[model samples]
Target: MFAIAAPSASAATACAKTTDPATPAAPSPGKPCWVDITPYPFGTDGLPVDTSSLGCPAVNAEKDRGYQSQCYLRVTSMAFRAWNRGLAATTRFQINPSPPPTPFGVWLFNGTRWYPDPTFPGASTCYGDTVVWAGKLDYWLIGGSLTGSGVPTVCRYDGSSFAWQPLEIPAETRVKVLSPEIASVRAGACYAWDDCWFFGPEGVRLHWDGTKLNDDTPDISSPSLRGRFGSAAARVDADGHRIGVAVRWTSHSSQDGVKPEDQVRPDPGESAPAQLLRSDGGAFAPFPFTPPTVPGPDDPWRTNLVAVDLDPSGRGWVAGNTVGAGNLQITGRILPGRQAAPVVPFALSGRAACTPSATAFTYAPTSSGLPDGQSSYIWNSLSVFPDSGDALAGGTERPAVGGTSRNDNGYAEPVLTRVGCAGAVTETRFREPDPTTNDAAVAPANYRGSLDAVAANAANDAWAATSSGSAIGGGIPTGVDQRFYQRPHLYRLTDTAKPAATAGDDVEDRPFEVVADPPIFVEDAPPPEPPPAPDEPPVITTVPTKPKRVKQKPSIYSPKVSKPRRIKGNRYVMVVTFRVRRPVTVGVQALRKNKVVSRSGLKRFKGKRGTLKLEITRKHWPTRVRFYTRSGSTR
Candidate 1:
């Protein structure tokens, strides 16, 4: 669990004050800033866990415009690594007596502040869960129980509150599977909230249609297929259809060793014949496309599909690593209608130069032992913007040096590849400022980890989640406990390409900090109005005769309510009408014995303010109807 302290208003005011107060400051429009808001000491309770998923709403969308620059990071596990050697007596580990019952945590940012979700419903006590943005103020949580011995729990947020959805898992498979491991969750392309899909290992697929869950598992008769990973873009086509893609493969690891508690990673022995499944608003089926092949020998098991994403135009992007001959990073696009494009090899040129050091390890030539530079560039996560076909691939890049052995040292840095719509690729490698230096422009320190997850909004702004720790083979110094060296980190890349705001610019060169203190721009005051001229006798003119004043009635009128119409089990819809002269918020309440019991929540009505009709849905029938507005009420 993590706790976030709200940034104080005083601190914001102090940062907004200009250093040179005599001169007005010019706005630095489209200036990019990287804010490092990593929680100190890792998890508040125990060791920090890797972020499992990242999601964000389209910042440019009309509905999400108010939630400027937002992203959600979900962490659902604990880190436990066994070091081979003992540490010095001075180094001690903070060990928890037991893991928390509900270890799932969701963190969010709202342009100004980053904080954890206080009202997350974690009744399942499950170790595996994911949160995905459905729509405005709506998100879906899907995963299995903590012990992986029961049916998965599905919860949803309905704008105002959270509730457990009545997801009906298949009765036959529920007992046999024990716990289902959900690998990916996506909001339905056509209906974000009303329709959603959950995918898991072995081709398990479940669909929720706003009411009950339906088993949409595709017919995968092959026993060799062990895992199925898939992703869908949130864009709907002209025909109101959403497209998605999935990869089914067999892992080299034994079934008994594959535990639900373990984080999802590409197994060394994993092999796929490049088989892909496509979803077109229905159950997934085999597609006629061939993924990028490994260059070495013609071995089916040599290539592994690590991540897949579909853009709004139904273009599919796949990222994976090939192990044969020499390790190679591969990425390519699948055009609409199952058309496979040329494989785009990840370019190592034009990347930030890596720092050479004694502790640096060379990129390994094979995946047999530890992952070295050879596999460093393989993307672990992929995110494609729905509005723009632009995509981002998160992985590690060892630009420090190229060698055959782990002893050949070079620092590894987290890398992000931006794949443009026109097939152009740009790479950004992150390096943190040296902590010992007061000047940020000095030599930087190596960021020794991979970006495990990444998300992008429609504005092209992106966020990446990684951890700060010693990389394997980046030899840890004596007396330093490896367990205490790692901490979860988050980085935000603001898109300065959007139109400049009318307000004052962001805090000048605000440096990244451990705390979540967002730059608060100062709003420029309106120019003073000029004084009326007094030199010309005030321009005296005859005034027209005034009409008599007429008193008007109140703008809000009483509501006309209709009887509740039962639609389904315990659900009913009631219609209410309100007459008003101006726009106002309307609310409905269910009452018993003159006491309010249930509320429909206030909904704003702004348009031609006459008679406004509203449909309120409730679970139970009310004895009396109470309709009210901000100004008036009617029972």
Candidate 2:
């Protein structure tokens, strides 16, 4: 007998390439994600860069109904050093350098191709952290100017060309806005800009009415307002309209010389660092309460709000991290609409814990599970697709498994997480070839890049940008200008062919294929041979019991044998019988010798019966016969 062992498909790696069940699957209802075709450098402009902003079809575009008509467009920011001449090839589009010798440019994608927009006034000086938002009829671009004029610039696209405009603001407000965010609103659009600081009145909000811009700067003089707001999301609510902002307080008021254990407890009456803001008709106010203490034994590590987005239910989601010794520990929560918001932290794995309570954060499981890498991972932006209602979180992560540390001259992976409307979460890490191994066309054990911005269309198509390329082997060889290799990259996550998503531990047996115990074949053990017939004493007729038969002729009539039955290996048993007209002798024997192997006692003419049982070890036949005298002759 032979046996075959068939296990579950998910438990085995059927192909050379398989999803690491250890990592989170890419957003749900889709296959795992792979690195996009675009290439970007690891670091540029002597600072960290990311694809900070994305513009797709606006969520409220359909609300405008008949007045809305637009194509899918995605814009991302990226910067390169002035000395990098091979930068043009780093992006999907051509990087047309400006007269001021601008090294950076904004890349545009129209479904199939990438187009570089280099005429945006200070394109060279702009950091790849460009803020892009799509309106009903135009697309807006806002960022700092390269001229170092301490002024932020805005460029509007009129379908055909871009018109640049410098904002009119007091120099005291700090002409440059480094971390800027834009949200589409009904009146026009609302934006949050800052002077690269958290304290004081360093943050400002700009409300545009399509024709003019108004300033709505909040008060920062109060210690209560000593935080910075970098993330903003606008949604129409019952209270007219609501714009939700993520506030990350930059300072801890007291407990200077406190011990580690004592540091976990906040000073009495101390305000929470993570707060929510509600803005109605340009009047902004706090949400009336603070978040429950996040999981931590140490004071929240260099924690800052980096990403914010509203789910289909209008609940706000925030993602940030507390900086640790060499890495950043990430945590997030969902902000409900009510004033008394309940603390619902994201379920994290390992030593991580939320503050005030040891209750584990609840998180939806992924195919491979959530990323528990050893190093740091930070989210840069988040947005919800209007049509699919899927929430996307974008950021960069240093893979816990491969390569050296960023400080040790290594790489990071760009990560995109998709959360379904039904609360299913899928995480995907982008994989790319190592630019450093171009000569041999090799991939780094851990490829690194930053996705600063992400935008998705109604079709569920998405796009992201890498602000710069790797410091090592990242750019294509350009003999004319070596600096061209340090260019940034833009990529699209369109609906393309991909592998099926693995179900992991969630896999279940189908109804028609339920599991069952294996069958057993008892070949070695055989049925026991029928017990040998008990030995019988010879039969003798008694004179008184049996009347004397006188001159009775003996005649044999019929004979028969039972079919053989196997009781053991190559062993069988059979029975035979014969009839006699008078007291006749009968015998059963193998035909080979014609000798009785077994015999029956005498029988009377009334008929007598006997039994023949034997084991057939080899091929043989048994014949039964009887001899008797009929009349005076024997036949």
Candidate 3:
């Protein structure tokens, strides 16, 4: 039977890189992450040096909207040192070096050709923690000087060119939960599900700042106000002592953000929904009137958060993709715990109207002849087998700038024998390589770059980076547009025959293969899903069987308006004339000293066309006529 486990994609990597799932095995000792996955960088200066020896792009792809662009950058270290001499290739346009001199550049790996990331080379990207930034910290660093402040964007990696591309999605766009980072010294973490994060009437733009979240991006309308924001964060600790912090923005906040259950209305037999319940670290009785709003209703702001402590008691932080009952959500560990009972505090919903309508995926790397089982740099979580599958996972240190291949046509797999998670290093891979397709939007090959991703397990390692190469090996979807399709794929480091399991670790030239579960885990009780977005309101296709009100319009002239409208007319009778439409509002005033001379008996009118005969006009005539509307406009 073709078995599909009902587990998070992370949980499926148990037997990753192994042909047989029935038995537990171990992969050969692997090297550091940098050695397993290959990447290249293009700087603002030019091409970088190449030490990986994985030949550079054979040809440079074109630059266009439909086609990819081209550019170059200098190569830096992948846990070691940077190199020189490489190529920039892609179909996105121009592979310009990102401002502030990013060591990591993006590449598109086409089968026979290589395409540099022609678009914004490094200004701003969704790729999270994996990539190295100036701070040496692992959070998703975003500092491309295109502030739109009418001034040149400022950044540290300035090689002259400092232009930021316009934002594709407009502001006021709600960001649900952006799971962008969790950086440590050892393994890194990040993930993006536009389906999960893109949300709300106002799109979100929350980001993490290593320790706390800095959600308050200047509002376009306000510019200085730091509003409620969404982001990701994590802190590292070993044996109880704090090491570092990891934080990220999953997707801003949920599109249809969190709301109190409509105040509950006391549920008749139930206690007052507002009645607070109490606990020590939890809620207090009657849930103090901590009104979600501050000061007043017009306050217009509130902030929500999701954070992590990498050093859990047993279970590590839990992060992954989850869906069921038409509701989808992205969950992250809030409290630091262990692999068994890690904190699963917060979750983002997928019911947003901004669900991912299209998707693109890469090859479903099959372990086949590779090692049986092993944890990867990305999957070294505490879970024995996060996933119930046979596979290994990994990410590359360099940007993907060559051809794509699933087979192992190389030298030695990584050689780091000490297989374990670290304080500074926390390992993690992507949700899935399943192609999420969209035609107009060239299917993105998510080798989201090392900053964004790259993990390696003993059995197999996987990396997602910009590629201009055609997919290799197997598992690509049928009838895909290979001509311009530089696809994404997972690669398992093939294993060498082991001698025995007597060694302390599965690595160190061992005999019996060491098998571990997949890299991800989710709670048994499903997480909460956000409400549907407001954009795509429910569609009512069918016509109503019963008749309904159709059209109605008000007349222009009225009996009272025939003559010059008088302000003070018949006392008890409003002699002014106006027509009545569906339902409208209008304000009339006797202008005096540039102010409306409203009297105690100012009469309120109901229709658009009315004969206003006031009883007390204070012996004055009306000055001006004005129209108002309840529907957000002036008539």
Candidate 4:
């Protein structure tokens, strides 16, 4: 969108002969015109300069307005350089003559403008920290070591500003030189910043209760048992009480002689099965089920748990990559009760065509418009919507068809996998616009980069951030300059509205249906038409006989229900297991207090047997289930 106008003598000269009614009268020749820039230039200050004509709309003219104007300008390289150079010669515009280098810290958006962490004295020290956890009411806890002293520190944000929270490190951990840097945090619903837990290297655990940090490391039976905690997620109730907490714990050893920075990498032969610690507003303990295995024997370098998240209903999800196999997988389970299901493969689609070779992963369009190769994903973040149990995993994907090379030689596009509450998986890939086009407007798309993080709120509004460059193990295209993609980008997704019914349209809103095979019959002859006419039998030469029919047995049988488990406040989850001789439509409803409060609308099952989970929110727990099949219903 770089359409620069010819340089004019003044603003008045640029707008002198506009025919459009919206155009305002030209301003005085010496006056500066207000300009609103897009694709925000983070390192530069916004200032109007005497330069090229933008042919801006007259609606932006402030003839009668006091200050703010509607003049808009898309930021281009030329315009940015001009604005920066003008800052040095002018005194009226108070802006930095030279912007500082990009800081190694997170960026904050205040709806209108972006502020780097360096702008805040309390937050600047925590720059380059890897762990950031969001809390209620826009509160955030950023964990890192003090800038110079290396003392572990955590800065708390109270919506507007940040203040460092005091810490009380345990003597044993300090003496061991365990580092104890905060690596994960889970904020529970409590007064102010109270009732939150901080986890870090060497199993360091601290609880903040608004006043002080308490060393609250859980005690395991085995003295030598230690692990590096990576991610911690929690679900809270309407009353601000913690319902459950799930943390990712990877096996580690202090005696391994690994440096603090390298502690996350397990020693040779030290990788263990994926472990998850759970808490019920109390001390953390091992979850009952085994989490999906992330590291294989051949590729032990894979992180144990890349990301973990909990839905509002307390269901937990774990996701990570399998480097050896070049696959990304995710698993979910109802917390503290159900068994962790096997890693479910993403139902991938919308893949771009690419050709796989030893040195290159190149897109090769097919005549039929079909993709040419398989795609592989590398997950970076996972988030579950608090209101809906839907989850989204964000990362980059590249073609992985038949290449033997481990290096990412192909162009990678941001990809997202969404898991719905109804147990459906969908994958989406966002490819930047083609840069070969001659249009200048399409040129900016070349700088768009890899998606790194994603988050969704209770409103189901989602936002994702992209880093400016290729991901780890990823590479830039052969002919592109790296500097052009230095700035990161953010994107937001709004939910789509459902289509309304049209007038006079008789659309049937029917649920899933299963039709059983027609029944077989064994016919029986009528007894000689009865004494039909016993009196008239002598006169009747012949009599016709009708047949009786009998119905055959059904193919579906043997249904079982599990005990109802309470999730939170009157909400319970119950599972039903059944076996069918053939595929059928299955539905379930919970009977609570002689009332059917919830139902799992009919769903088609292709397998001969499976389990259906039903959730109900009522005062009384369900005692039994009413299972439905196409053939009939069962208790």
How big is the positional error of residue 209 in model 1, measured in Å on the Cα after superposition?
A: 1.7
Candidate lDDT values, in order: 0.43, 0.38, 0.25, 0.41
What would the per-residue lDDT of candidate 1 be over residues 1-635, giving only the tens digit for each residue? 55543422112211111112331122222543344443321233322222332332333332212111222222321110001100000011112254344322544444444444555544344223445555334455554343354444555555322333434456543433323443223222223555666666555666766556676664444433344443433445566666656654333221212233321232344443334566666665655445454222222343345566654456655565433111222222211111111123221112221121122111233223233433345455676654555667776665534333322233455566777655666666544333322353311122455666776544424556663433222213343322222344555454334312212211122111122236679899999999987775656688889999999765567657765544344445555666776676777777766766666656666654433222334533357767776775654
Query: What is the C-alpha local distance difference test score of candidate 4?
Result: 0.41
Error of 3 at 614 (Å): 70
Q: Clashes in model 1: which pairs?
A: 126-146, 354-400, 360-409, 363-373, 364-373
Q: Estimated TM-score per prediction?
A: 0.53, 0.45, 0.23, 0.46
Best by TM-score: 1
What does candidate 3's lDDT look like per residue over 1-635, in tens digits? Answer: 11111212222223232111332343333421211122232322233223223443423333111112223232211110011111221112124453343323433222122233344345333221222222111112232222434221212211111222222222222232121121111122222111011111122333323222223222324212111221222222234322222222112233323233211222234422221111121111222211121111222222121222222122223222100000111132211111111112111111111111121111111123122122211111111111111111122211112112332221112211111232122222222232323322221233222222222222332222323332232223553333332322232223332211111211111111223335566669766998877787687899769878776554333434222322223321123456665344443333445554432222345555444332224454445433333432223
**Prediction 2 global C-alpha lDDT:** 0.38
TM-score-best of 2 and 4? 4
Query: Which residue pairs clash within candidate 4?
Result: 1-441, 24-58
Residue-level lDDT of model 4, residues 77-124, one tens digit each, is 000011101100000111125323223233343323333333334333
* Clashes per candidate, residues 3 or more apart or on different chains: 5, 36, 175, 2
Model 2 misplaced regions, further than 4 Å = 1-35, 38-104, 117-119, 122-128, 145-162, 171-201, 236-274, 288-302, 311-313, 323-375, 387-389, 403-411, 420-423, 432-446, 467-489, 496-635
The alpha-carbon RMSD values of the candidates against the true structure, listed in the order shown, are 22.6, 33.9, 29.0, 28.9
Highest lDDT scorer = 1
